[model samples]
Target: MNFKEKIFSILSNKEFDNLTWNIFHDQIKNNITYKNYLQFLEINPFEIKNISEIPFLPISFFKTHRIFSSRTTDDYDIIFTSSGTTGIKSKHYVKNLNIYIDSIRNSFEFFYGPIEKFKFLGFIPTNRKDSSLIYMIKYLIQQTHKNGSHFIPYHNYKDIFSNQNDKNIFIFGLSFFLLDFIEKNNHLQQNMQKNESKNKVIIMETGGMKGKRKEIIREELHDILKKFFCVKEIHSEYGMTELLSQAYAKKNGKFQCPPWMKVYIRDPEDPFIHINNNKIGGIDIIDLSNYLSCPFISTEDLGKKINDNEFEVLGRMDFSDIRGCNLMTPHFLEC
Candidate 1:
């Protein structure tokens, strides 16, 4: 089967006026345990059913449970554990590493093919030796015949920023890290004097930002990045521990779900009733790449579903925000 057909059949047992929920349910259910999921779908396959009936496996289980199939050993690599977020502990996943890397490279080339020749300066924390950005940047740097530099400084941004050559360079940092870096070393402010008008020498941040230091507003943060990094756009990355695909946003601060993944906004109180667009509710992700694991993943994050492929991640729901963070706090840190 082709990739698209396999995804469609794996996700839906019966057709529906709304393909979103069926695909969403099928992906998550099958990921949990293929046999159990198939039986559940066969037994409960209706023309339409409320998303409420769908069980929400705890978001923390990326730590607590081994959700992926143990028998299927091929085409999967157990990636690193998440340091985790508030109220939940660290979680683990076996990533279909080849597929994961290829998708990331494809997305990067699509977005950045125009500026294939610019030097890359990464200031973010790479989660693994095989990080998506790290590996992709290496390729882009070589493809363009440019250099790649990772400014790994220990608690000093001034020294790091001072070390740069100041020609055309692309800076990619995690949101919190960038904020903290800029806040401490105000001198990097000089690099902004040079501009790459066509490619918009962007400053991008991957998702793992919320749990850290200060709470930042989207526009305010963008303004800070522009002021500090001297860049026109602040790209934001949309990725989670369990899923392989990623979505990118151009510092416009709105997360547009990639074609391979679907997002649903559910009632916070109900957390499963499919709500109307522009309504604030829980964000549930249905990822096609979760074929080896649970695909219909429901996140505790509240979001607004304005369109089929768009969502605004509005932080966590209920006491879950505080409650979830608590699960991740270290024994020493709690004191």
Candidate 2:
């Protein structure tokens, strides 16, 4: 079905990228119901002769039922379980996931340039959560280690920072965990001299001022991260568990979508309408890395589009009008 040519053709061309997204988006929005979606997949079933036959499974459907397009379990390199706002588990079956992983690695290289190997610090949630920062950080650490890191720091942020006067250090942290670690260990904070002329460091944290504190100004959070880590600013990572690629912004920064990930702004008043660049609207993402699963996802995030490949994430919707994952569970369980 010329699958390789078809997929790459769309990804390789700027016009084809947007064109495919438009068709894919319309298919989902026009009929997102389970019954209708099955029909859609039936019509789009993988045909070795035709690229139009390849079917993509909607991620939400995985919560209730398995949606493996592969013929056997051995076909998958690994399975990733997606966490919900509630604790209910949803496993995403990945077939030939190597392509997805490679795309991700290449995208990071394209965006951040080359990353030097160094001591890796992880401050991520051990348990299940809707956010996939923990999973993504683990991958980042592994890459650093494989390429060349003196060592990966997994414990005692205090000790890790004590002997860190030299060497290029790369620290990846979670927002809340990092905050608590900093507050408890003031000595670590006091010992570090702010702004070293030759010190090379990168502190990348994902997620935001959601659960940790009621509200945190983006600039303030960036300042606090810089002070605590003795870095310039907190390099924030924007990604979802459901997405194959991640967007990165430097400390106290906004998100810049990677080459493999394309973001679009949909009108807030009408989800089906695409707003002009710079308008705040619902966030839609199309990630080439999400190929093994669903590459297109409509999110509840309120954001403004800056360009073809950049956005300013405004934050989640308020509680008054729409309940989050917890409130929506009843409806899902009913299915």
TM-score of 2: 0.72
In model 1, which regions exceed 4 Å deviation? 1-58, 69-76, 85-88, 110-118, 126-169, 194-199, 208-212, 320-335
lDDT per residue, candidate 1, 221-282, as tens digits? Answer: 78887777566778887776666666677657677754456677766555435688899877
What TM-score does structure 1 among the candidates reach? 0.71
Residue-level lDDT tens digits of model 2 in 196-307: 5445777877666445655676677678777776775678777765666678886346688655566777665545456788887667776654544456566667788777
